[model samples]
Target: MLAQLLCKTGLNSLNLNTKLFVSLMLLLAMATQSTAVVAQTDRLTLIYVSEMTEMDSEEKGSYPKLASLLEHYRQINNHLVFISGGGGLAPSAMSSLDMGAHIIDLLNAIEPVAMVAGKREFSFGEDVLSLRTYEAAFPVISSNIFDPITQENLDGVNDSLLMTVDGVTIGLLALLPPIAHQEYNLQRVEIQSPVDALKQRANELRSAGADRVILTYSCCYRDYLNYFDELDQLLHDGLIDLALGKDEHLLLADHQLDQMHPAHIWITQGDEVAVVELTLEKDAPTFLMNWQTDSMNAYPADAQVQMLVDGYIQRLESLLNEVIADVKTEFATFQTDVRTAENPFGNLLADVIKAHADAEIALVNGGYIRGERQYQIGEQLARRDIMRELPFRDQVVLVEVSGEQLLLALENGFSQIEEIKGRFPHVSGMQVEYDRRKPVGKRVVSVRVAEQPLLPQQTYRLATRQFIATGGDGFDMFGDLEPLRYAGQSNRLIADILIDAIQQSQQIAPLNEGRLIDLSSP
Candidate 1:
């Protein structure tokens, strides 16, 4: 009967399905024969989803297909459990109407055991997530993040989880990304080094007598192989049975998986999922990874998930559909545009910050303009569109700094050009010329503000987001500014300022205007 359920609902990946079918088929055959039944061990399955951004839903991602798919598996296998890799919680502005609260509801329906906290979760701040975590059916874990304000681990976040399924003591641990501390400064939590935190957490899990351990590694694209030797050692010592991660860049192809014998099973996000079947026998637990990382558009939407999604759409219909601004020319914000060079949206954002703060210059990180979609020339920019584009809910403020500090800030912005990170500055009321070929920390060839060379001794009013004002993304020089305060109060959102500016102007056109030039780039 269990075999019938599995056969009817196929595994997403052929390779995993083969392993699952081969192993389970034998059990099914034995069951049908009514032979002297050998003591059969149960199959424990782990279902996972990760990195769910605003666009990752039936309407934008795979269909309601995921919710019902897991529900079926959960029904058939009492040992089956769902878990998340912790990225689905932020840029709340872009997610379903309640700003990703709908996503929480969706994740809850599947009933995750634990979810790792990722960098995106920090974007929403702890207060908001603290309330929303109550809405979740599962525990949120962040081994590396501790609440600086409360001097404890972040509220509503667990370091790890432990459970027993079919007599197998399973452990789940979550590792927040290591770079969180440098990129985000929360009023609530502080991020410890992930490596140290993970080690401590892993030891605790082993001490707790977990037979199998699963790790939620949100690091994803980093060169973890170099340091994964530790995890490899854990696997060899039998401390860790499996490493569950979601890194699209590091996924192993089906044909190549066996050769690697990887301790980790990395799932690529999107509409895809990983169904891991753990065969529990007297000896060490064995694993079969079913990685289905493609063609989610073809997957049919599950009815239950569809119902939830429909309800959210209905609730947000009025607000989401509202046309906030009508575009005249295209205001595209491709990743390439935001990180490497100036684009329409980036340029407009810089202009808005300068205008709103009534400051001489403004430099906002290109990374702050979030999203993967590009807007068209004539399309109506809805409230949803704006929210998705600027999701962090950051405030705009003014700081007075010397021209010398401004130059250093510009230098810091260009220092990480190779990585194409958020530190890349989009400027207004100023022009920058840099040679990428030059060494890091010395890339700025020339910078001029207000049509004149910056006088080192002179102080000027600067405008930027609170993230930058707080020394996030490595612009620490800005932190030295005096008389720093919100241009209005601390209440003005950068997104609102931009939206209102576009509505007032009735047109959106921002030129590159040679604000930043890289001679090394063609």
Candidate 2:
């Protein structure tokens, strides 16, 4: 309108120079107006849920509840992206039987834009992970993990993902801990430095016209401090817009929200969901971010999703409902009890594995017992109960180590007592006394095996999870030592071994024989 008005008001007698100046002014004004229109903010709603495998439990975070919450957002928001932070595929009762195929089926109903490959994705090893990934309807991504033999991303997994929502381009990248290969029993995948992977990928995303870059990492609690520092630097330098973390449940439980880094968010338990709102500036590489966490209880279960969940549950119950044993006493499997002190369930687990391997001693990490609840006296233990308690499907293996190496392994277990790490050992055929007041490596006061004092020079047969025998949970002292009884030698998993033991005994009693003595306890 302004241009037309200027043209109509122009006098025929105006000089050429004057007319040219007026024309230039009109063009400048038009350009400014177009710029203003282009600079409008684009809103994006990102719903992030991590450790989705935890949804299998009878908690508020079940798949039906999450599906309802997501559907609600989908209805209200035009631009929404659902992200599964991975770690949901394994370590659950159902996952133990199906190798996470059921998890993939459930997640397919609530299709995520992308799912990050968490450490637990490798729970059953590379071939199983490949099968799970193949069954996924969404992209499974991990930028820092690759197949060493193929020099490519793992089968059916992507290195990264580019998604466009409401005209805003988003770059999604995921990182598995560098030690994931060792910790998660990864045989075919190799991990690169996450920092290097992020730096390289973020730049590529930006160059490829990404408006925002989000990183998802599955790192254990102890690695969070280091990852946070690196993430803060990336955010400060504008390499990544945001970071979502998984496998930091303990850190999330211990720390306050105010203590968290501004650009980093840790996914809490399955019962909660983190919603991130982003305001992307048009033609600019900046965005405004707001995060809010909501409980799954806020939404009613989607009827369709509920049906699907019920179907799976019904199928699982048929196979798992058989009674395995009758309990004569309360069996404790709470995390605080199993991870920090001698637990009756842990004692039984160690004894079962030891007996199965016919080894002189057995060591079970507190983390291995995951029931997280007590079984009261007179309660019937079912196959389902055993599966939930020992969901990892890890094999029991026997290994021979010098008594000195055994002591070092014991020290490693006691070293992380303050953190209540899973490395804390539950023992059979041995009594260990440790003083927390002493330095980490020097905390072991004494260790006796078979009622005999530990001899540093003598070799002892140790039965443990294949995970520990291969040096998981910081038990590097056991690394590279060939197992006396290879895990593959037995077709039975630890859960299977325990189930047989319970069946043979018919009735079980809680046994805490003071095998793990904390001298520092008052």
- The top-ranked prediction according to lDDT is 2
Q: Across residues 427-468, which tens digit of lDDT does each residue of candidate 1 receive?
A: 999888898889887888888888898898999898888888
TM-score of 2: 0.86
Candidate 2 lDDT tens digits, 447-480: 9998999999999999999889888877878888
- Clash count, one per candidate: 3, 1
Error of 2 at 380 (Å): 2.0
| Sliding window of 10 residues with minimal summed lDDT for model 2 | 1-10
* Candidate 1 global TM-score: 0.84
Distance (Å) between predicted and true CA of 95, model 1?
5.0
For all predictions, the C-alpha RMSD in Å is 8.1, 12.4
